[model samples]
Target: MSAVELNPRPVRVSPLIKFTRWSLLGLGILYGAFHHNRFSKIENARREKEEAERPAREARLAAEKKRASEAEIKYLGELMTTNK
Candidate 1:
């Protein structure tokens, strides 16, 4: 009878796997450096623009109110002077 022997195979790492790992790490770093702050700045600018428009909006509302009051007074005066 012949004796049989079994040998364990060595695991091999592919170059593609190493490349993918490095690429993913580099992409993560670049995304954080370039995109994070830009998004924040855009958000801040949008907030500031919205805040700046608030006063103009309030002024427009005030003008509309004054115009309405003038119209009411004119209407009351015309009604008082009319004869039915």
Candidate 2:
């Protein structure tokens, strides 16, 4: 007997199977594109809302910090007066 076999060809795929595979791939591409656009629009809207609120948030934080500083100064001054 020889070392190698006589038949070495690969089997052929059917045309219908090929068509189904290509159509599924195209559908998946379309689904991904739609979801991508939708999510990006939602994210953009959120970013715009945050930008609109930024200045007001900063002002509120600054006011809180100033109040805390004044309270601390008043407390220390009262303590000094009691000690003397």
Candidate with best TM-score: 2
Segments of candidate 1 deviating more than 4 angstroms? 1-12, 59-84
**Residue range 5-84, candidate 2, lDDT tens digits:** 79868779899999999999999999999999999999999999999999999999999999999999999999999999
**List of clashing residue pairs for candidate 2:** none
The stretch of ten residues in a row with the least summed lDDT in candidate 2 is 1-10
The local distance difference test score of each candidate is 0.92, 0.97
**Per-residue lDDT of candidate 1, residues 1-84 (tens digit):** 336537656678799998999999999999998898999999999999989999999999999999999999999999988954
Q: By summed lDDT, which 10 consecutive residues of candidate 1 come out lowest?
A: 1-10
- Candidate topping lDDT: 2
Residue 68, model 1: Cα distance from true site in angstroms: 9.6
